[model samples]
Target: MALCEAEKTFVLHGVEENFRIDGREREDYRPMELETDIVSHAFGSARLRLANTDVLVAVKIEVDTPFPERPFEGKLEFFVDCSANATPDFEGRGGEGVAIEISNTLSAAYSSPNVFDLKKLCILKGKKCWKVYVDILLLECGGNLFDAVSLAVKAALWNTQVPLVKQIDIDGNNVEIKVSEELYDCRKLDVEKAPILVTVCKIGEHCIVDPNVAEEQCSVGSVVVAVSEDKFSTILQTGTGSLHMSTLVDCLQLGIKVAQRLDAALWDTLTLECYTCSTTEDESDTTCLDNPSGVVGGVTDCDKKYCIIVRVDYKDPRGKLASILRSCVDKPTYTNDVIEDETHRVYYRSCRTAKCNGGSGRSDSTSDDNGSLGDKSTIYCPGIGDGAVAVTVSFSILLFAYAFVRYVR
Candidate 1:
């Protein structure tokens, strides 16, 4: 739908006020949530959500003959899929145009050898080399897809786990590669110098960062700037509007500054292995939402139930009451309950619930006075079998819930 004159005027006025419709300054960005190592089946994977925009990236490695001219280097290919989930207009081949545009831009950004050293991926000169395929799935489009996709792709590569090459045997015209049998004996991709793209949207001669859907619709033009360790790697103009040389240079400078900050923040989050979740660093699993089997505590378990709990320490009465209830049960199955008291207001829901009958007995409450449930928390199950399988299954659910509530918040 087209925006009315008054709405447009309001947006323009807001921009003049140095604040956009989303209550953010022109240079401010929407809240971004990132998770790496999400797709286990792939070599490396990451999921990035910037406000309403959701992007998933996976990297797959394959052996292939190197190009005759570039025999010493490997190859990197980008493929983007604009899923129907992003928008009904993207159903089937409808999103192909946008997908191609995004993929092409990514390819251009990574084409420079300095941005990504293809030589590091080569298994052998001229004959065989590792081909890295970066596949991006767009789940939702809230705007600023280019920036989000670029960040996801970089993060996925950072989390990529490459198998260790034990030996390479060449016989006649055939080449054979031996991979390490030990799972942990893998090589991690070097991504310390990965590039991050930032989109600068020009609205009424003013530039902005991380524009939302509404803002994108109003912007006349945009410039995508890719920066690696504060160096400008690539710059591409987008949209139909024309930009003067000086304005384009100004936008590029701003984009580089923003990208440097973004890259640092992303690296910090990626390296953070500790979380409030119940699972230890060694036990945590990573899973993506697009997979048929839901990712539970980062692990792919299609048949199991998973829940995410957010704790609010606010002094609102409603929040305090909900926290109290969550603390009482090992797993809070009552999602509809909204408790209000004099202290705080809270919103909590049951992500998943499974009914299992076990031994008939009431178990002691394992929660604390502060409404915190520990990792060893348990619930009474009636008619549950005494076998190890039953016990393991039951405990896994509790552990999943505990970890979900702890980390997802």
Candidate 2:
């Protein structure tokens, strides 16, 4: 979608006033919805919806021979596919250029060992190692592709569960490595210091962090800065326009600050998503969602961070609420009730295994009001079950009395 001069000016004026079209500040980002394990076939997968932009990333691990030059390190490759559904421009081979650009940018950003350690994926020094393939699918493009893609990739990696190596046997020229067969018995990637790419666009004299479709058209040039920890991992100049040396420095500074904020926010969101959804093989089991460390009901009262409960209404007269809940959440959940009032309703509570602090670090054994995990009892609403049982018993007694009276007569 092309923005006219008048529309561009409106966006520029809003930036100047620190109020965007969506009523967000210059540094503020649009509301984001993130879900992990969306792709059952893939080892680790995540879907991130950033306003109008939607991105899905899946991580697949394969065992392959390590490079002769870098015998100790594993391999990380990125492949991007821009679906035609996102835009007509991406039809057929039309999106190949954009896809290549995105893939190359991600490859460069993650090339540094400090950003992602490849040594951890090694099985046998030079013979065998895990090759991590990160496949990204661009479902929707609403501008700010670089930022959204990076965030989704990081979240997918965090949600990924790499199998643990139990035993390795090497006989003669043949070498064998045994990985743990248990589903949950896996190792988690240390993505605490993962790099986050932030795109800073030069609009007039000021620079903006996240530019919308209209705002992007008004930019003179844009710089994508990949921030890792306190330093910059890679800086790439995008768009056709040029930036002065001073302007470039200013852009880097803005990019770093914005990336920090973005990284923190991303971790908070990922943790929340992980906490609410259990990574259990049997998602239908309500017992897995129970947290032994906290009070009843998904969210606790003492917890300061607010929990967002999403209510979905489906148009199924037969009421397939259990299947719907299973499709959305991997955690075990019981249907609390089917409201017989104004509407046919099913209520589900978010499950949490451990306490999440909306930050990078999560407690290993702490439980809060949100619920707990690991052999904990599931959240049970006694009133609904008891009432149903009472009604059934009363009906059975009445039927028995009528049958006896008829027989006697």
TM-score each candidate.
0.67, 0.69
Q: State the TM-score for model 1.
A: 0.67
lDDT, candidates in the order shown: 0.66, 0.66
Tens digit of lDDT per residue, candidate 1, span 173-238? 899999999875677777667788899988886888888877777778899988887688778888
Candidate No. with top lDDT:
2
Q: How accurate is candidate 2 locally (lDDT)?
A: 0.66
- The CA lDDT at 351 in model 1 is 35
Candidate 1, position 344, lDDT:
44
Error of 2 at 286 (Å): 29
Considering every candidate listed, which one attains the maximal TM-score?
2
Model 2 regions more than 4 Å off: 272-350, 353-409
